[model samples]
Target: MSSIRARLLAALLAGMTVVTLLGTYAIYVNARDAVDELFDYQLRQLALSLRDQAVHHSFAPPAETVAEDFDFVIQVWNPDGVRVYFSQPHRTLPGLAQLGYASITTPDAEWRVFATRLGESIIQVAQPMRVRNAMALNAATRVLVPAFVLLPVLSLLIWLIVGKGLSPLKKLARAVSRRGAQALDPLPVARVPEEVLPVVCALNDLLARLDAALTAQRAFVADAAHELRTPIAALQLQVQLIERAGCEEERAAATTDLKAGVRRASRAVQQLLILARQGSDAESPTLQDFDLGELARSVITGHSVLAAEKAIDLGYTGHEGEVLHLRADAAALQVLLENLVGNAIRYTQRGGRVDVAATRRPAGNIVLEVSDNGPGIPPAERERVFDRFYRGTTAEEPGSGLGLAIVRAIAERHRAKLELDDSEMGGLRVRLTFPMPEHPPASP
Candidate 1:
């Protein structure tokens, strides 16, 4: 059962054997019937042939004999019930006189008898039943003898045919087994049968997906290592500067710079961990109906103090009472909004206006945007801002460059669209458009 070849071969042979047995039995039965008819005809002809002989009182016994000591017996009984002629002298077929064909049982065997009444004699002719049975068995044997030799040959042919039909699967398995663990390439499907093509296609899809995931993981690891190295080395140098300072003034100054460096390195490590976690499980399904307007307001409030420190105007301008809804993982959506609004606050200059808005437009799309009237990314560099560790030409602030990349990942998770364009407020507009909610928002 563990081997497909053994399983199929056993099933085929078992079914064929059953059919062959039933067929042979049918053939033997039909042939026996035909043989019986042939012998019966011979009996009738022999009886007819002896009719032209003279009517006699005594008969010379037949010179030849068979198993019953006679092949056939002839008797003529006159009208007075006296036996006039008998073909076998010693053996007799015992029965009351029957005018037509009848079975007459004797001491040695049964006989097939045909009796008829002529003008002055009762003509009786009989043959042994054993002889009829022997001829029938011989005929049935002749018809069935070839099948006995043919059964083994037919079984061999069936086995070869089944193996030929399954050879492609064997080749496919061997090809797969030859692959190294690092090889994540798709399997070949062109030479496979139509029945197996779907399985191969599914396996290829799995391999392609696994390969993409592994490649992304490697890239993330390398980029994170490179990004963390700079700040960590700076922190180490700052720590040495603090420890080796010659006076209190110099030591105090070094301590402040070292703490600042620690903050920067800590912030960078935090951002990298966030990016890695999000990338590791990009599409974890935790969907629920939530108000996007409420979420936008919450995110903007968290960054209000940061905006205040820069003397930048930060506020939410969404509709007061209406809910803009969506079904998605709330944690991912929160991260996305924080990145957008935090970047807007961090890069904007003093007195620059930054406004966060969640709106349901006339086209049934829910749009969330953070607009800042500050120096923004140039049109030529807008697309590259989403790449990890990429900074625009105009960027002068100390920051990790994973903000927009994380935003893009979250947008993709929600099937939302992210776009950057020149704001009507005379700076950059970072907009994320989500499709209409799948279900109505909860009553608040």
Candidate 2:
């Protein structure tokens, strides 16, 4: 894995080295120019000084006597170009040339020569190019050597600074790792850098949501346990009654009651399962474009036998044979409709009417309503009806009290608006308004 500190250190060190090399090259070039100018000036001054000095035709110094470090090679010649005098018996002395400065290349080395007139004779002062080059190299080495020596120190400093800058991220990782599974508390946000603040805030928000979901799950489990206790106990009691019956008639009656108790227990268990499945953190619904009116008719038909037994007039009263299209989770919407229609059938008085309808409003919203001519919920208790395990004060029927709660949960998932109101039929009307899609699918 590539570490941020390592990458930063390498990049910084590489950049510093490149800059150092460039700086050294610039210093070498400038030093070379300065040395060349100084040496050229010295050559001109030497040639001018020789103009007044005495010159001997055979005054050349012995080759062995010349110092190894000696750089200048002075020479003189007559107007006829015959060599007259030379300061040193150098192997590569430049020949006499026209007055002023010039450069000449010999087999051994290149020379910078300054020639001037000394009365009838001509004097020439020359120096090798290698001498000036050595001076420039020494000047550049003074700068380059220090930079190379300090490179390790610069690399160390860069590594420490990069690590220090990343300390906040390290702290955050440690804090997250130390948390327990049940520790859903928000992470600290204080002293967080501006660049990392958004990440911390988002994590805090996620923790808050998880805490709420876990709390609701715990409550749901507890409530389900409490609600199931009564029916299960009743089933046991009814079985005991059947076992104790003395006559054939008494045993038959006891068996019938036991069956009823079993049915009630089964119904309660089913409702509890439905409630759990519709909880906030339950699996997402499968949404599709389906006919809402058809779903309503189907739900009413399923509850028709029960409605008929009680003499309740259960029927669909929406537009005949017209499709009331809606975009929603079809299965969840079916469950919502079943709960509404079943509750209406169970609670309406004998010979009363329970109507289920689905219609599209002019403003492009789908409205689903299940209304019944039964004793309506009081206005004060309407809001509380949607709470889990809550029943109306005047309720006389056996129920798990989760029907309306399930309906409300499904409505919330679909982002639909649910309302409880007095129906025109003189009873409760549960209406749900679902917003239409901006661009609806094409009909077949």
Candidate 3:
């Protein structure tokens, strides 16, 4: 069969054939019962008729001609149960009781017998059971032959019907096969059956997400290429200038420029590395309890030279109680703090102020703020400052614009929130807040 409908139809027809055979057997049994009743009644009446003939004649009569018509035997027995006459002289049929009708077996075969009593003797009439059984077999065969012939034809018709029932599923398969690889449009769900609608809707949602990811990746690549080209070109020019300098002083000046270019390029490369390690579902960083105050102090100490060189004040001003134990990736926290402090030190002029502080709030929350007296980011450009290669409106410093972006990436990885507000130094305030771990040391 070409379809499921056809297969089902064939199966149904085969089942019907089996049922029909059973029905024919039942009908045959009913017919055999009816015929046996009529035959037995005829034998009973024949015995009574022969008895009357003998009584009227008052003689031990010669053998009767009843056997010529009925193809059976007739016998008579005296009242003392002595056999007087036999229809088949080769084998004697046994006389039965004077009751209605009975059956008996001879040496050769079985017989159906009828018996009745006369004045002084009993008469019996019987027929062989083999003849009756043969007749029943012939009749049953005649009735069942037609059903056997029609079974195959009905099976074929059933197969065709089942094939038609599965047509819709085949059509859906073909429609899906014709689509191209990048075709993300949703399949039409309106005409589909209820069982299949959910599958189509899910595919459509997947396609929509794929389209958005592709667009974002394109924008990221373009921005990265644009950002990397500037430093690379500057490094190349600085190297060439160092080579072509005419005097020792000129060569020394070119070497300094070359070193500066190398530093910028190294920073750009480090930013890219941080971005690569920043987002992964599988590689969550190890977290531990760390003192926020200690971390802030350490970051400030690392940047002491920068602050001293610029003549700016850089130090910590927060609670002395170590009540601010935080759960975070320590490495990421260090990177985050270093970037914020570095940015603050870079932007502030000589004699400017930069403060690092970690303060504990009321409800297991620790607030860490790094503020500077440099020109602050304007309100309109603060949001874009976290974007890759996005520089703030008041940013006139010479550096890659990825420091805040790296800070945001690290914060997101740790599920912490970083906010920007107006600093007490009349400049920018970059605050990083995280929940304090429960069951920590009260104070140390």
Candidate 4:
């Protein structure tokens, strides 16, 4: 039952056996019925022939050898019930015959008798029931014998046909089993059966995705190694400088630079972690409606100390009230704003003006901008600045070069567009455009 071939063969054989038995029994029953009708008809004819002969003569014709064996028995009885003529003499059959045809049974056997009245006598013909039944069974067996013989051959043919039909499935399984660990290439679907085509296609899609993921993972590891090497080497050199310094002032200067290098390396690693997390599985972003102006104000306030340390004026503009809001990831957008503002403050000269602004466009889109009067990136290096660890020629400040890269990653995660332009404050302006949600709810 566990094997499909066995189950199919068993079911087929059992059905064939049952049908054969039923048909054979039907044939036998029909044959026996036909035999009964034929023999009864013979008995009637014999009785009439005897009556005609008795009318023409006084006795029956000579009995044949078949009449003496399993043939019909004939008798003539007078009106007074005295035996007159006998074809095969029998004592157990009644001395008298009943009118018409009837079955007469005695202790010895059962007989089918047909009788008719002649001019002055009655002629009767009778045959045994057992003999008629045997004749019918013999006829049925002769016809059904060949069919029973072919049953086994036909069953084997069915088993072979079913096994051949399933060969393609076995081939597919073998092909999959022989693949190696690095074989993330898609499986072929061209020769696959239509019934299994969907399964093969889904597997191919999964393999393609897996291959792309492994490639990205390898690149990430290599990039991380290369980026970490510089800060670690700088830390080691700073440590050596501190160890070799003889005066207290020299030791303090080296220690300060060492701590700064440590801070920069830690910041780079943190940004790398953020970029990796944002690049993965970006289908359903955690989105909710929040005020863009409020977030801008908070970011500017957080950078105020840094702005003051350089004597720069950091302020917000164009955001009178909460008209600009978007459905986006709050934490990711917050990180994006922090990176933009922090980078602007870091690169700007002392006393330079930095402006953070939020404005709603005529098309109902929200635009957020962080602009500064710092020596901004050249037009040639503007696009490259977004690349991971790609610093500009004008960038002389101490930075890990991951700030804009992190900003770009977070902006992409929120489905926002980032563009670089010249600021009115005579520096770079990083503009982010957030599209208005279709079918947005009424503003509160």
Give the per-residue lDDT digits (tens) of candidate 3, residues 201-293.
Answer: 786787777766566567767877899999889888988998899999999999999898888889888887787567432278788878879
For model 1 the local lDDT of residue 160 reads 86
Candidate closer to the true structure by lDDT (higher is better), 1 or 3: 1
Model 2 poorest ten-residue lDDT run: 89-98
Candidate of highest TM-score: 2
Runs in model 4 lying further than 4 Å from the true structure: 1-181, 194-199, 281-284, 438-442
Candidate 1: tens digits of C-alpha lDDT, residues 1-444: 297767877887788667766776776677667866776676677767767767656664444732355476777788888777776767756543678778778887887778777676777787787777676667656655776677678778877888898888888788878989779999977778997788788889988988999899889889989998998898888889988999999999999998898898888888887787677456585898788889888988888888888888899988887877678888888988898888888888888899999898898888888999989889999999999999888899988899999888878777788999999888999999887666666666
Ranking by TM-score: 2, 1, 4, 3
Residue range 359-441, candidate 4, lDDT tens digits: 98889888999999999888889899988778888889877677888888778776689999899978999999987787675
The whole-model lDDT of each prediction reads: 0.81, 0.89, 0.78, 0.83
**Candidates 2 and 3: which is better by TM-score?**
2
| lDDT for residue 436 in candidate 2, whole number 0-100 | 74
